[model samples]
Target: MGARELTIVLLSAPTDCVDDDRTEQSLGLAYIASTLQAHGYSVEVIELTGLRSSELATALHRIPAVDVYGLTCYSTNYHSVRQIVTHLRSHHPGAYLCLGGPHPTALPTATLEDLQIDSVVVGDGELAFLSIVDALKRGRRILGAVGAIAPNDLDDLPFPNRHLVDQKTFTRTLNHCRTLSLISSRGCRHRCLHCNSVVMGGARKRVKFRSTGNIISEIRELKKMGYGALRFSDDNFADNPDLANLLSAIAKEDILYRVFSRLEQLEPATVQRLADSGCKLISVGLESLNPKNLRFLGKAGMLHCLKNLEHTERHGITVRASFMVGLPYDTDASIQHFFEKASRLPFTEYAIYALLPYPGTPLWENPERYGYEIVDADFTHYVQMGVGRQTAFVLKHTDPETGFTFHPADVLRWHCLAHDLFSSKRHMSNSQVG
Candidate 1:
């Protein structure tokens, strides 16, 4: 029998609480699978987004023969990944298993020591994964390896294989419009404390962009694939010379979309161009209103962000102001100040979040410097919402407060208060629009 038919399974831990919930295919996994396909490997994508735990093990067992199994996960799904990987190791003893993505990339040694995963891909999985597969194909031992970032030539990577997963059943839906996710660039080296970008990208604080032609080509492809809009998943799309060219080209296309970008990059001219280019909304990550916290995140002053928000709003683009709590030295006064500013801002929507120190972030590595102690080292509790096994608990706390005994609970409470105030404002605004 000529060269044995190589088979691989790519799994993404389910994000949905309910089974049958669908979503766009995991871009990272799809991209890796595409690379493998180009190398003559048979691949299938198993997105565990909505499967119930009781059904998961059996379901995975039912898939076709697998010589290699690859899993992509974030911190929130650490336990689920363990469960899945453990099952595979126990049942498919001869198969090679690997893990990639933010969690494994940040803690490659810990990942391999866990004993469930045979190998870990540390950085971008495209090249690293190809290498691992080639090594395995040759029957060479390459365990305990770390994947590194792709070389600077981002343009050389193939576009994500959108066909690997069903587009109609599993796609991003916004107001009855079909949306596809695309990342025109990668690696924002911004020093946002809670960010895990450093581990996934690199420490150079440099960004690389896809060629403008390549970007528009993907957009055109998405359009041809029946996507009415594009959701860019870049951490923050910084303004560059190439962006204007891309936006100008996109203006001729028939699509609407939104993007997350830095406040500093949104100059008057850039905001105007974004609006004119069918940009429906711009998400500004106002991580905190506290000046120290702002500086900590390498963000400009709060006034600078506010001005950008105002400018974007005046240009007829919806401003989605996203805020986070649970930072070092956050006080009741600071949270209240944030609420006042957020309520008064002329924005379309607002969201509040708690800071969960992800594995590779400075915050997680050195919590003592921030004056909070890490009470738990379990990676599964890094989740931000809900109260299930997958939901992360707040395992860090401050020293006893003088009055309120401040802690993560207080941060959550303040976040709730802020959320309620803005939600009411949003409701009233919608009423007025009606």
Candidate 2:
């Protein structure tokens, strides 16, 4: 097949309440585009916010016929993917449609089964995507079954084509001077029953970390570009000892950054090193206080992890603690216990989210066991809006030996309102004290 001019339009599906204001382009797509372009294929990534379903169809109709159409899907935009695929199949029947990212990786069979989608790239799509484009150019049939799926080897993947995304969109969402998203590694070691990473990356867990030299090079490049703050998006940033070494290296470079850490792994010395390394914030997942509830969610260390928040705070690094309200083991008393414990902690900011059982997660596999009913399968509802049966409230018949119940959404709402009221009262009390 001679060099083919392929018009690849990348679209980020919309989220629930979040408007189309800034369509965050997936860094994965940018990597794939860069690889494909290196292999001599024409590609263009466009954020699909302003275009309506029909308007998108009209726009596609006007463009020169595309060889392949690639669409990126997250858990929140699965439905939008279906809609776009359906429309594209009807309007532009000849163009090949491909889906990638967390959603497609998690539900490859479903994506392939859907008549509209031609193929789904499972993991580390750079090589797989290039292969698919090559196959298409050679007039070979592309099948959806997992092909060329490999572990995320950071060294192999090209630096993300940040130039593809609109600079204005990024500036509005991210404080680039103080904030830049950096993916030092890929894949997670811990399998939280409710997390999408477990489903997408698979059970064995293939993790690849960028070499310290490569990471420092990128940091230096970003620093030269005038980015002040760095945010590492690794699922478990502090899991490896080498992470400490990485921090030490960053400190040598005088770079400041923020990272998410599992509470269990954090040690006082490590916390001090993190602080000395110019670490400004540490986000810890203090999902719940109940040991039984924590075990059920596959969290190994409950108490020690929760205690690390204090250590992080004491080290002069702000702790952004996250907690989940509804778990199968939660009751009214447990909810109160969570609040009391959280209020005692020196968290600079707290984010509370109701348990959302995304499909393909262990929780979704046995919703009844978790006391969660399928409120809706639509991916938009998967964000944080839809309600599910509190796992803590209902007893499992099969597991009569053990049972639990909790109303996640209700408790979360109460927490939000309580925080507001408590803050107001605190302010009044301070004024009276003055």
lDDT of 2 by residue, 1-434 (tens): 23555567665654334434243356777778888887887688766654544555555554444667788887676766777777778777888888888877777897788646778887667788888888877778587755545635567666766677664555222223435567787778888888887765644356667887788888887677676567777787877548777878889877667788888777888898888988876777777777877887888576755667778879878776666656666666666766676667666665555677776787767777655665555555555432221122111212234444334345555556435433412321112110
lDDT of 1 by residue, 52-91 (tens): 6677777767755588889997876777788888788888
- TM values, all candidates: 0.91, 0.84
Q: What is the C-alpha RMSD, rounded to one decimal, of candidate 1?
A: 3.4
The lowest-lDDT stretch of 10 consecutive residues in candidate 1 is: 425-434
Highest lDDT: give the candidate number.
1
lDDT of 2 at 260: 82
What does candidate 2 score on TM?
0.84
- List of clashing residue pairs for candidate 2: 178-229, 328-391, 328-392, 392-404, 392-405, 392-406, 393-405, 393-406
Candidate 2, residue 340: lDDT: 71
Candidate 1, which segments miss by more than 4 Å at Cα? 15-22, 385-405, 427-434
Candidate 1 global lDDT: 0.73
